[model samples]
Target: MIIRHFSSLFIAVLVISVGCEKTDRDRFNPLDPLNTTTGGRPQGLQAVAGHERVLLSWADLAIDAVTSYRLRRQDNGGNETIVDLAERPLSATFIDSTVVNGQTYTYRLSVLIQESEGGVIQESPASVPVEVTPGPNICWIADEGLTQILTMTSDIRAVDRQITSIFGAKHLAVDPRNGAAWTTTQFGGADGAVAVRFSSKGVIDRTVTGFTFPASVVVDPRDGAIWIADIGATVGEESSVSRFNQNGGLLFKITGFSEPSGLAVNPNTGACWVADRGNNTLHLIGDDGTILLNINGPGQPTAVSVDPTTGDAWGINVATQQVFKIRSDGTISLSVSGFIQPVRLACSALDGSCWVVDAGGGQVIRLRASTPDGYHIGQQSDFHLSLTDFFVPVDVSIDQISGQVWIVDRGDGSVVKIAANGSIIRRFVGLALPVALTVDAGPR
Candidate 1:
């Protein structure tokens, strides 16, 4: 009975000892040299371009038992990796070698001490993940009407956001509901591409791989699906149009036109207008991809915009500067002329004016309501970034609330935000070579 009592007491002591044991992992410091002078604060860490390495650094602590710093990385959709710690306070930055491009990587930190800062060692909170990525695969945009002008420049490289795709892209349309941008990549080197949304900042949401190249894109307000004009070739004898859901699911594909270029969705009519530039025609398709009206017109009409107010459609001639009016009967009428290299068009939601981007003349001409319209030159402004400057601009969009205008400079690879006074406020770089800037400011 005495032996049994002794055994019970021994087991209790063993359990107590195991619970009190400390581990090496519980004692390491963060990658940054903790600065107690700043109340043990750390600062000034940077990530270099074109590398997977992240430099972690901090100031040394002023009055605590900080001996070392520990660094760890958290990858939300990938494998977790730990960065080794520094034994002493850092003079330079510590490097983390296990990061990758195009992944959501975040970091956590801790401090190792002599048990004086506290009775035990403790870790710090993790930081919000820093997303590292390379570049976008493709994006779609509306060609704010310039292709109709005979004197228009054929330089596709001016407004092309992808460096690899210089002279082969057209339009840009953004889905304000879904925050996705769709634009047409032209036919030159890589066939054509369409409907690439920015899933995150500077990252494309391309979920499919094997589909043929696409042209223009517009998101359906009814079902949130993306409709694309898949010409497949610039000079093919036949072509088709396709539809994709917001989830990258291939919903539908329809073939009819010889070559499809421009796409416009009418809200009131719930119809999609497609410009058959190859056959010099326009086809109005219902929501279910059924053909409603096939309008034939003058030589190769490129740019088209639907009138929400009247259900009318306007198009630009690739061989001439004439803006044609497309009646429901598919008849064409000349509206304007004397345009220099007119290529793309955007109809405004606020004033209902049509903004034309003439890449050849380096000018953005605005036409207020209807065909046979007069042009109003916007405030010609200089775009400044670092030391360089941009003279001519391509596409433009405005915020309805603040009345601020944003434009993309084909001369420079930058997008600039302009005040109501046409003064440059802020600029964002690294967009390859931006030609168009479209914003989806929600519900306005």
Candidate 2:
């Protein structure tokens, strides 16, 4: 009987010991690295703005535990995209290039961890949201007849900010230093002719008077001085070239031009080149209103332009259907003929080539700096743009930012925008007269 009692005690001890072992195994924590739970959320999430991109960065929670990271981005329009970055946990940096300018974006970051046995993923909570806005690309155009300046997108969409109260606004020049625009007006009466300055936001910053008929205006990019081609009351009564400070104070006036139509400043040398239609000559004037050189043209020179890259000046003769290229030293390098009453000319600062408007031919011609025929004088045009739908194309301007050409057709009162590939992008109509048009790269 004693032996049977001892055996029962041993069996009871074995049962108790086995129960305690099972309890310990059931209390194991699943949050351990060998299990399924992940590390803490990523910290220090950041989104930096760029031209058309956003850079994302974050701090890693546990480098050894994390197998990868996930990034989430959302735009202002509520569009969301999730990206999985495998095997990139430490020093995590990502660039989102599929973004547009002038847009805002939000971002979030999280880390992924794997279980030691099953390789299952467990993601931590995302970091706090970050936001950024990219820089926008825009352009501006001036309408002389309507006395308004229109701001446009890269694709020709008009913005809400239209500059008004500019009376008889003729030609416009945008300062490269600041995006400010300068123009000449003939609207104020006998003393109405003035040079006006407009800020980038379409506000009139200042106005300088004492001009009889301010036909053309330009700003010296080097010193920010204002230059005006003041065509006097009578044909040769008071015609002069005037210079003014950034404020409305007159610096000096050089009189001699009998009908100055257009003017351009040499960015390299700071010299002002004017086209005098009355004398059929192109005059190169120094910054102090002193005549430096006189270049005689084939006929009446109506418009002038200077290539900033090479400091070469180009002028168009309306009476002789010719284009004159003057070197930086005031010597005539080459004079090409074949145009039909070219009214205006402009040279690309980025490239040495030029564009001229032909009113008689109803077309625009593009000329290269060097001719393939090896002749420096009187070479044929590289290409001619004759849009069948356009008539009486008088003035032309190029947007350096977009590399697009804009033409003012006086016959239809329309503005035609052409792409760099010679494709007609859009034709803006409903304008009255539209005698002159100038473009400004509104903001970067």
Candidate 3:
């Protein structure tokens, strides 16, 4: 009986000892406390503004303890969204590309801490809210009739702003590097004609002086340098191409051209191709004022354009009614005749196609690359259209992305947008003798 009672007491002691061991383990466990305790909040939260997005960054306080991060965002209208950073737990930066331009946004950050082996999750406090507002996508248009530069949305819905002080604003080009539009004044003093760089808000930032007759302006695609074609006061004397930095400071000038009319720069090669009517030659110039190739033959080359895809240059001769293609190696590859006084040309960067403006015919011609087995080397006319509303189209610009063509009708004082299929999209009227037109690759 005593042995049985001792065995029962030993079993009872064993049971109590095991229970006490379990209780101690639960009370002193390091991982148990971590599962219940939250980590430190994220610090140094910041928001950087972008065209249509906001970039957020933060300093992780308990990076070693955090298993994931949570990003919270709220707009000015009080809409909220929570984003989990499970895939990039340690990433300190996040780009909120879903944001809209011109809208204010607030952001906060927090961290999720979990004990090893999948313990309870604890969330730290959110960081202080950071606010940011993005810049809107805008288009700049030069109006010769109104003698002003108009800022409008990409959809051409409304005129956001206008700079009315600019007189004789014949041609304009946008410098994407600084959101400033450079325009040429046809009439100026003895020193030379003036080109004014105006901000998107219609503020004149700087005036570039000393151009004899600034007829055309283009921005270098490789760099943001400005190139102006100065048609000299005389027939062939002093006609030159001038290069200017983004600040309107003259970089250098290239002389000895008879009459530099149209200008285009190849983004890949940084070569400026000028159509000089005085000498009836296509001058391919380097960034450092080096004449890489001067091909003489196209009768009175009026306008020149560089194909972004193939680096091929195209020039239209209004006198000969012919279009010539210059290869990247500075050789005349092909020439197509039978156009009615093609004055201006714009080539697409997305494709090797081009658009030609025929002032004599009052029409625009669309040219595209021939098929694999076709005879033409560079391009051939796909179709030609004479818009019923156009009287005399002077200049043409193409939106490479959307394949939209913008034509400046000088005779009727209108700017018309046409789709790639020769369909008229929209026409903006009520301008006074619109001479030049350009399209910006807004907010890429």
Best by TM-score: 2
lDDT of 3 by residue, 216-277 (tens): 88987556888998888464448888888877788898888877888888877777888888
**Model 3 CA deviation exceeding 4 Å by range:** 1-139, 188-192, 235-237, 371-389
TM-scores for every predicted model: 0.54, 0.65, 0.65
Ranking by lDDT: 3, 2, 1
What lDDT does the true structure give each of the candidates?
0.54, 0.72, 0.73
**Candidate 2 residue 226 C-alpha distance from true site, Å:** 1.5
Q: Pairing residues by index, what is the TM-score of model 2?
A: 0.65
How far residue 255's Cα lies from its native spot in candidate 2, in Å, is 0.8
Tens-digit lDDT track of model 1 for 1-444: 999999999999988777766321242333333422222223333333223444555445443555555556667665666654655443435666665533445655545555564477644444323433311111233333332101000111112222232344455556656555655554333423344455423355553333355666776765667778877665543477777777667867788677787887775665788888878888888877788987765568777777555666767777876555666566664465545666676555555555555666665555555434332232221221111244456665554344445566666555565544445655544344455555544332
**Superposed model 2: Cα runs more than 4 Å off:** 1-99, 102-139, 189-191, 233-236, 372-389
Evaluation by lDDT, superior candidate among 1 and 3 = 3
Model 3 root-mean-square deviation: 18.5
lDDT of 1 at 243: 71
Model 3 TM-score is 0.65
Best by lDDT: 3
